[model samples]
Target chain A: MKELLEKIFENIYSNGLSEERYCDIKEFISEKLISEYNDYVMNREIVAKNKVNTLDIVLPNAKVGDYYSQLLKIEDEEIIEYWIEGLKKTGLEVVSEIVLDFQKEDNTMVQGSANLEVFDNDNIECQKQVIGTKNKGLVIKGNPIMSGDFDLTLKYKYKGWFDGCNILERKLRFAINPDPRSLWKDIPTDKNIKFYKDDFVSEYVTVLANDKGLQKDIVAASKRGRSHAHEGKARDDDFKLYHNDENGWYIIAVADGAGSAKYSRKGSEIACETSVEYCKQALQMPTELEETILELSKAEEGYSNRSISTLIYNIIGGAAHKAHRAILDVVKANEDQVRDYATTLLLAICKKFDFGWFVASFWVGDGAMCIYDKERQYIKLLGTPDGGEYAGQTRFLTMPEIFTPESIMSRLKYSIEEDFSALILMTDGVSDPFFETDANLNKVEKWNELWENINKEVDLTDDNSESKNQLLNWLDFWSAGNHDDRTIAILY
Target chain B: MRRLPVYLLIDTSGSMRGEPIESVKVGIESMISTLRQDPYALETVNISIITYDRDVKIIFPLTPLDELQLPDIVTPDSGPTHTGAALEKLCSQVEKEVKLSTPEQKGDWMPLLFIMTDGHPSDIMIYNQVIKKVKQHNFASIIACAAGMKAKVEPLKQLTNEVYSLDTMDSSSFKKFFKWVSDLIEVGNKSIGATDELLLPTPPEEMNRII
Candidate 1:
C-alpha cells in the first residue's frame, strides 16, 4: 500500500488532475480488495458453505453473496484484520492510530497519530479526530514509514440489510520546495513532493512608459500577472495609460474585474480605457473652469475647495458615469447582467503645474493609489477602500450611483496633492499582498518592502529603457500566495 | 485559500423510514452532483453530514467534494428524535472544526449550516441550551427546514431567522428543497469572502414557505 501510494503521488505531481488522482487511487484499492475477496471465496467455496451452515443452521435462504458481504462488513473485526494483512502484503506497517494537528502551534512538523484504512484501490486514511483550534493548513504526525504520502480510510459499518460499505479515502501531497509565504504551512522538504505548477513562468513587455517629451522619466508599466488561470485568466484586470504631452498632462487608470463577473475582464479593459480617455478630454475642457478651481481652493467662505474640488470631481465623476454607461451598453446589447461586467475603477491625472505638479486622483472601491516622495522618503495613501456591505462586495463602476450627481459626489473620492514624488495606481491584486487590508494601506514599511522587492527585480536607481521592462517583469512577482491578476501604473 | 465548510444536520428517526429517507438520500446526492458542476464551488466548498436518531452520528467529516463519496444514510429501527443530542454534537463539532483567523494568516470562510428535521425534539430543555451554544459560533448563515405534518416551526425560529416549513413531505418537495440549497451554495461560492449574508436563492413558494 505504501509503495503504490508513493508511486501514485509521484504520478499525480508529474501529470494528473488532483480529482483524477483520487479516482485512480480509489479504483486500485477496490480492485485489489475485491480480487482478494474473490480469491478467498473461490478457494473455500465448499468449506465456507459447510462452516456457514454449521454456524447458522437456522439460516434457510442465504446465498454465497450474502455470506461474502457479511464477511467483508466493517463490523467484523476479522474482516478488518484481513484488510490489515492485505496492507501488510503491500509493505505497509499498520498502526492502531495516528493524530493530525492542523494547527502546528509549535511550528513543528511531526506531532500526532493517524488511523489507517483501505478502499478498493486507493489506500488512504480518514482523519480520526480534528483538534485544531486555529486555521493552519495540513500537519501530519505519528511516525509513519511512508514518505511523500499518507493513507487513511474511513471505517463505515455496513449492515446485512445494506449491500456495500461506504468508505472515503484521503491522501496528503506536500510540495517539495514550498514557498515560505504559502498558505499551506510547514510543508516537509521532501524530494518527491512538488508544488503543482502547470504553467512555466514567461517574460514579456506588455506595456511601458512612453516618455516622448516629459520633464522627467515618467515610469508606467502594466502586465497580466499569474492568476487562478495559468495562461492568464480568460479575462485579465486592466490598466489604460494616457500620455498627453501636448497638454503637459499624463494619466494612468486601472480597473480590477471582479473574479465572479463573467464579462468583468472586458469591463475592466473598457473602464480603464474610457476613464483615461475622459480624463484627457477633461484636460481639453475650456480653461474657464481653471480660474474658478484655482479660486475656490484659496477661498475660505461658503464652500472652500468646493469649486476646484467640484471641477476635479466632475471630470472623474463624469468619466465614471461614461464607463458605467459603456458597461450598460454592452449588457443591453448582449442581453446580459450588469453584474456580469462588474469592476472597480481607479483613475489618476497628473498635470505639470508651474509650481511643481498638480495631481487629481479618483477611485470607487478597493485597491489603492499612493504618493511617494523621494526627498521625504514617505508614502501617502490617497483614499480608504469603499468596502460595501460585504468584504468581497465593493462599489463597481456599473452601480447606479455613478449616474446621479449627488450620489456620485458621495460615492466617488477625489484627492489633490502637490510637492509629491510620484503617482502610483494599482488593482487589489497588487495591493492585497503588500497591504493585508485597506486599513493598512498607509503602512510605509509595507510599501517600502514592495519597493525593495521591486528593486531586487529591477534597478530603480537608474531610470533607463531597461527599467520599463524590469518593472513590467517585476509586476509579475509571486507574493502571499494570491494568484489574482495584477496591474500597477505609475507616473514617477 | 480557505474552504467554505457547510454542515448538514439530518434527522433519521423511526418515522423517516420509507420514501422520506430515500428521497433525502437522493436529494443530497443530487445536490453534491449539482454543486460539483460549478467551478467556484468545486474549488472551495467542503461538506459535512451528521445524522441524529436516538444518538448522533457524524456520517462524514468536513471534506472537499473532489474527495467525497456519497454515504448511505440508514433510518434507525425505532428511536426517539434526539434533536438535542444532534445540536450538542454540532456545537462541539463547530468548536473542533471551525478555524479562526490569525494576524499572519487568513481563516476559513464562515461556515454555513442546515438543520433538517421532521418531528419535535424529545429533549426540549437540552435542545434550547445547545441551540444557544450553536449561535455563539457566529455562523455565516443558519437555515432550518421543518418537514412533515408533525414538524413544528416555533422551535426552529429560535435557532435562526432563516427557517422554512415544507408544504408537504414527499420526494418531489424534498428534491426541490435540496436543489434550492445547492443553488444557494453555488451562489455563495462566488462571494465566499463577503462580510454580509449572501443573497440566497428563494425556496419555491409552492413547496416551502418561510417561517
Candidate 2:
C-alpha cells in the first residue's frame, strides 16, 4: 500500500504538476470537511428524509474510466474512487459488495465500503474533530442494493494485476458493543466481596500462596491499555470489560461468534456482557460459575437457530476447571451451529505477582494455550490451537475435544524478566500455523518478532507526515497482502 | 427464587386444527406477559414447549420468564401426531438437562409438564416407555388434559392418572384453562418449599365467583 501510495504520489507529481498543487491533503481535508458538513445535514434530514437536498447521482460511463477525472459536487463536496488495482477504470462492470465482519464482541471491519459517505454529527451536516472516541471514517460506502432506483457506482481502471494470497495467519478482531456499564466496570455496584486465600492447583502442581500475594499479580491483566484493538474489539466484543468495583479486581471475558447459526454473533455479545453482569451479581447475587454454566446449558438445550456463548469470569482469583466433571460445557451441535453457535469461553482474575498472575483467558471451541510465565513454554491450558481433532476427529459442542482438568499441564516458575511487558493471544487461525513443530522456528520466532515490533515506538521527533508515515510503514510491513485479518491486543 | 420449570406439551396432531392452536399461542403469550407483571412469577416460572406431529420438536427450551418468548404456535402443516415419540423426546431432553443441574438452578425436582391433546398416542409401546422414563427422571409432572369430543383418555392415563376433560373444547375454554394454570403457578411459587404438590384451580361448579 505504501508503494502504491508512493507511486500514485510520484505519478501525480511528475505528469500532473499543473493540477497537482491543488491535490494536496490540505485541499483534500478542506474538501472533506465540506462534505462532512453535508453528510451531517443529509443524515439529519434522512431521519425525516424529504427535507434534504438530493444529489444528481450518476454512474460513471463504462468507457470513460480514469480517462475522465473530475469531482462531482453534491450538497458541496467531492467523492472519489481510485482504481488502485484493476483494468480500465471505466467499462469494467465493477461489482461492489459491502461486508461488515461483526464479531462476538461487536468489533466491526466494514471492508470495501459502499454507500460511501462522510460520517456526520447531530445538526447532521457538520463534521467533528477526529480525536477521543469521536465517530470518524477514512472511507466507507455500501448500502444493500435495496431498490432498483439507486445511486450510480463509479469504476476505476488500475495499473497492475492483483494476486490474492492464501492466508499466512488468521487474525480475528473482536470489538465490544455493549453499554459501557455492561462490560467495562463503569457501572457502579454496591456489593462487597471478601477475598480469601486457598490452595491453588494447576495440572501438575499446586501453589500455596498467601492471600495478599495472589491478588497483586492477578490485577495486572485488568489494567486497560492503548491499542487499536482495544477500541475496535471493544466496540465489537463485550469481552474487553474486565474490571471491578473494589478489591483487587480483574475480569476475563470471552465471546464465541457462532460460525454456523444465523445471529449467533448476538449470542457471543450476550455471553460477554452478561458475564460481567452475572459476575457483578455474584456479589449480592453470589451464583457460582459452575451453577451458572449448568443453568446456561439447561437454558440453551433445545432452542434452534440460536447460538450458545459462554463467558466465565473469575472475580476473586483465577481458576481452570480442576474437577473431573468439566465445570463448563458450552455446545453447538452441528455444522449449522458449529459455525454460529461458536462459543468462546474466558477465564480471568487478578492474582499476586509472586503467587503467580491471575491468568484469565478464553477457549474458543478447542483452541489451547500454554502460558509460559515461569518455565515450561508449552503451557497447555485449554484446547488445541489448530481447532482440529485427531485423525479426522471433530466435536461440535455436542462433543468437544477440550482439555479436561485432568489432562491439563500446569504452569511452574517464571523464566522471563519479572517485568512482564506484553500478553499475547491467538484465535486458532494463527496458532495452528505458528506452532507447527520444533525447529520450525515459525510460531515462537514470529510471535517474539511480532511482540517486539508492536512494543517498539518510533521517535516522535519527525513532522506529522513523517511520524504518521512511520506507523503507516509498520502497518504496511505487518500487513502487506497477508490475506489475514490479524489483530493482537498489547497490554502496555 | 424458587424456580418452577413449566413444560408445555401441545398436540400439533391432525386433531388440533385452527382455533385451538391459535388460542394456545395467545394463551401462552398472555400468560407470559401476565407472569412478567408479577415479580414472583417473573423470577420463578420458566417455560419450555414441545410440539408433536409426524415427529417431535422441542419448540422452546426451559427458559426463565424474560427469555421465554410466547412462541407463535402454528399447527402442523400436514403430519400425524406421534404422541409416543414426542413424549420420548421430551424425556430425553429432560434427562440431559436434569443430570446437569446444580444448586443455582431454581428447582431440584422435575418441571411441571402439561400435555394437552385430543387424541391418543400413535404408538402405545413407545408411549409406555416414555412414561416410565419420565417417571424415573422425575423431571416433569404429567397433567394430561383431554380436549375435543373425541378425546383420548386411556393412553393419557398411562402417563398420569391426573387426567381431565375440558368442559368444552373452544378458544375461551383454552384461555380459562391457561389462566387457571397461571394462577396455580402464582400460588405454587408463593408457597414454594411448603408443598411439593401443585395447586390446582377449582371447576366452575366449585367456585361461584371468579377472583
Of the candidates shown, which would achieve the greatest DockQ relative to the real structure?
Answer: 1
lDDT of 1 by residue, A357-432 (tens): 5566777767788887766777767666665322354677777865677666665544345566567787777787
**Two-chain DockQ for model 2:** 0.02
Worst 10 residues of 2 chain B by lDDT: B99-108
- Evaluating just chain A, the predictions reach TM-scores of 0.57, 0.33
Candidate 2 residue-wise lDDT, A411-469, digit = tens? 11112123333344332223323432222322354455544463365222212223333
Model 2 has an lDDT value of 0.41
How many times do residue backbones clash in model 2? 65
| Residue A249, candidate 1: alpha-carbon lDDT | 67
Docking class of 1: incorrect
TM-score between candidate 1 and the true structure: 0.55
